[model samples]
Target: MARTLVIDAHPDATSLCAALVDRYAAGAREAGAEVEVIVLRDLAFDVHLRRGLRADQPLEPDLVRAQGALIAADHVVVVAPVWWGSVPALLKGFLDRTLERGWAYRYRSNGLPQGLLAGRSARVIVTTDSPGWWLRGLMGDSAVRQLTRSTLRFCGLKPVRATRIGVVHGSTPERRESWLRKVSDLGRSDARRTPDAGKAMPAPREIASDAAV
Candidate 1:
């Protein structure tokens, strides 16, 4: 069975992002995948990388378990909220502190990066109050690019997919439900594919649009 890890990067468990994580995990489990979740708010760990890879900083117990989960997963799903055209500080801190140099990636002899977390796929879901045009045209999809290209892909998670749900501030309850269903469907679809199968899947430039907002 495929193993999937869902990372809830929202600071508040009552946020919409958390609901999305729950729905996605439920869908994956329903599709027969073994699902694991890492709720950043619940984990006890220092978010700061004080040494900046220059010195050794021991991993906290929760972070150690998180790394183990990442190592065992075939797919990784990150659910976060966009703030100031980027992900929350908590999520950024998690990335900085968790995806370390020797574990997630290492420098090649030629000074290039060799991502060790190869053979895995990823999906990023971000919620924002901004309209699709503003987030894409003005913000240049900063949060999406950071998670999908700069981080996950840099660590060798291929075929990274992204979904944006937005204008959330005044969105109707029905619209929220629609977004939840879409995310759930995405989870089910992703769970059906094995790691190798994911390599063959053509990633959509944008899985869902907030143009309707």
Candidate 2:
């Protein structure tokens, strides 16, 4: 069976991002995949990588467990809200503090870094207030690059796929439902695609009042 881990990067438990993760997990479970969720806000850990790679910032127990889940999972799904044209600081901090050298990557004989977490696949779901296409066309999709190319890919996760759920602020309840259904379907399709290698989850529909984008 596929082992999938969903990481919620939003600070608010009641956020739309959280709802999306729950729906995605529900879809994955219905498809027969084993799913686990990590709510960053609920965990007790510091977000700062104070000394960068040179500092031996010890991993907290929760972080250790998180790393184990990440290493063992066949697929990783990251859900977060886009803030200031990028991911929230909570998510950024989690990445900075968790995906460290030696475990995530290490310099090889040729002086180039080699990714350690190979054979895993990842999906990044980003919620934004702006239209996705417009954001991509205007701002060059920095969030996607940061999550896919700069982070997951750099750490050896293959074929990182991203989904942008947006215009949340002005969207109607009907539109939100449609987006939720779409994401749920994606989860089902992904679970069925590789049975052993699961696909990433998509963004969910949020309550209009609690919507971010």
TM-scores of the models, in the given order? Answer: 0.90, 0.89
Residue pairs with backbone atoms closer than 3 Å in model 1 (clashes): none
Question: Any runs in candidate 2 off by more than 4 Å, and if so which?
Answer: 195-213
Clash count for candidate 1 is: 0
In candidate 2, residue 127 scores what lDDT?
Answer: 88
Highest-lDDT candidate? 1
| lDDT for residue 63 in candidate 2, whole number 0-100 | 75
Residue 206 in candidate 1, Cα distance off native in Å: 39
Candidate number achieving the greatest TM-score relative to the actual structure: 1
Error of 1 at 146 (Å): 0.5
Q: Model 2 Cα RMSD, Å?
A: 8.7
For residues 137-188, write the lDDT of model 2, one tens digit per residue.
Answer: 9888888889999999999998688988888898888888887887787677
Shift in Å, residue 143, candidate 2: 0.7
